[model samples]
Target: MATLKVLGAGPVKRGITQIAAEFAKASGHQVNVEFTGAPTVRERVFAGEVVDVAVVPAATMDEFAAAGCIAPATRAKLGHARMGLAMRKGAVAPDLSSTEAFRRAVEKADAVVANLANSGNYVAKLVGDLGFAADKVQRQPDAVKVMEQVASSPQQLLGAGQLPEIRELIDKGVAVELAGPLPDALQSVTAYDAAVAAASANAAAAAEFTAWLATPAARTAMAATGID
Candidate 1:
């Protein structure tokens, strides 16, 4: 009953699409959820790509709305997300139950991959939150590159994963056991939101889908996909 063109950043993209598919099945409509990092999503939107709704990071969403890409008033603050650290499955998962342990893990780690835009901000915030601001390790801006590097490297660190994505990434050659888990304070959530594009062709449908995202059914789907 609906068709939504949405944009999302990494970290929770796999979960995002899984939930979107479920929503589509329930809504009796086709939902096309595009997955990309915050930077690429911004690039696409800013470059004038056509889309109906978006579920990017809260900060990026606000900027897009302010820039007239998304309807300012149509914006709704979604919930938060957790950025994690993943290693090779056979290796040791980092001890990140605390700030100190997280720092140790990152310091002792080999390679670190993170999104340069939204995920990067969250990971950076997490770094600062974990008192590792001085570490000065830069996470990559692209998710594919991050995934590739981690898979090839025996010891790699990933900075995203809300659950099923983590599981999927692990299956896709992510260094699960070799890398580690997300940090403690780094466990901060990124508030996701929905908004209609000002130039959308189906504003009503977009609004309906956005509203659906906040429903219990949607939340149930999101939770099932590892979104908070």
Candidate 2:
């Protein structure tokens, strides 16, 4: 078996990294996993980086395969993530139970922190739909960064992103508490998938590891990291 270089995006970061570690331990194979923005991951793969396996949005897995960046037959479904809201611990968790309530909370917040990638893009679109000025939304590099900003900032804020990312913050005691999932009507689910890179020197190992992501132990690992 050869060393596996795994490229992953924001939403799948925590879970996939842990699962990869478990795979490495069991298989005695070294797996180097890098977590970054979805766009960045796509760019890297397109740029011909050493990506043996890619864990990204399902749609991206398809696009990459179509573009000949990854092996066409190597795709495997991972899990889904839902956008949600978070607030610093002890702050009033705003009412996001309904669309109207959620809208008002976003409007009233001193700052609404959101990621600049998937969840962030979704939020930016929502902000436009609500007719709010773009300046009202503060975009961070990723969900964890949003939590970091909200935890350290003095202003009252509401952070919105994938529930798993928010949970990652709470798990690390980042002074943030989940408000809850977005209003059911507005909730957006992003499913993730993994595939072996077409250029991988160790395609066999990569394919085997990609398949392992669907195993029971992998699900447990994903669940442990707040990914379902």
**Cα lDDT listed for each candidate:** 0.66, 0.85
Worst 10 residues of 2 by lDDT: 219-228
Badly placed stretches (over 4 Å) of model 1 are: 1-3, 22-28, 122-138, 155-164, 171-183
Which parts of model 2 are misplaced by more than 4 Å?
none
Residue 200 of model 1: what lDDT? 85
Candidate 1 residue-wise lDDT, 115-211, digit = tens: 5765566666665655564354456656555555665665555444444456566666655532445656546567777788888888887777777
Write down the TM-score of every candidate: 0.79, 0.95
How do the residues 1-228 of candidate 2 rate in per-residue lDDT, one tens digit apiece?
679999899667887888888888888788999888888888888888877998889888878978888887878888788899888788988888899998899888887888878778888889779888888899988777899888888898888889888887688789988888999999899989899998999999998898889898888878776677
Question: Relative to the unseen true structure, what is the C-alpha lDDT of residue 73 in candidate 1, on a scale of 0 to 100?
Answer: 71
lDDT of 2: 0.85
Q: How many backbone clashes does candidate 2 have?
A: 0
The candidate scoring highest on lDDT is 2
Candidate 1 versus the native: TM-score?
Answer: 0.79
Q: What lDDT does candidate 2 reach at residue 18?
A: 81
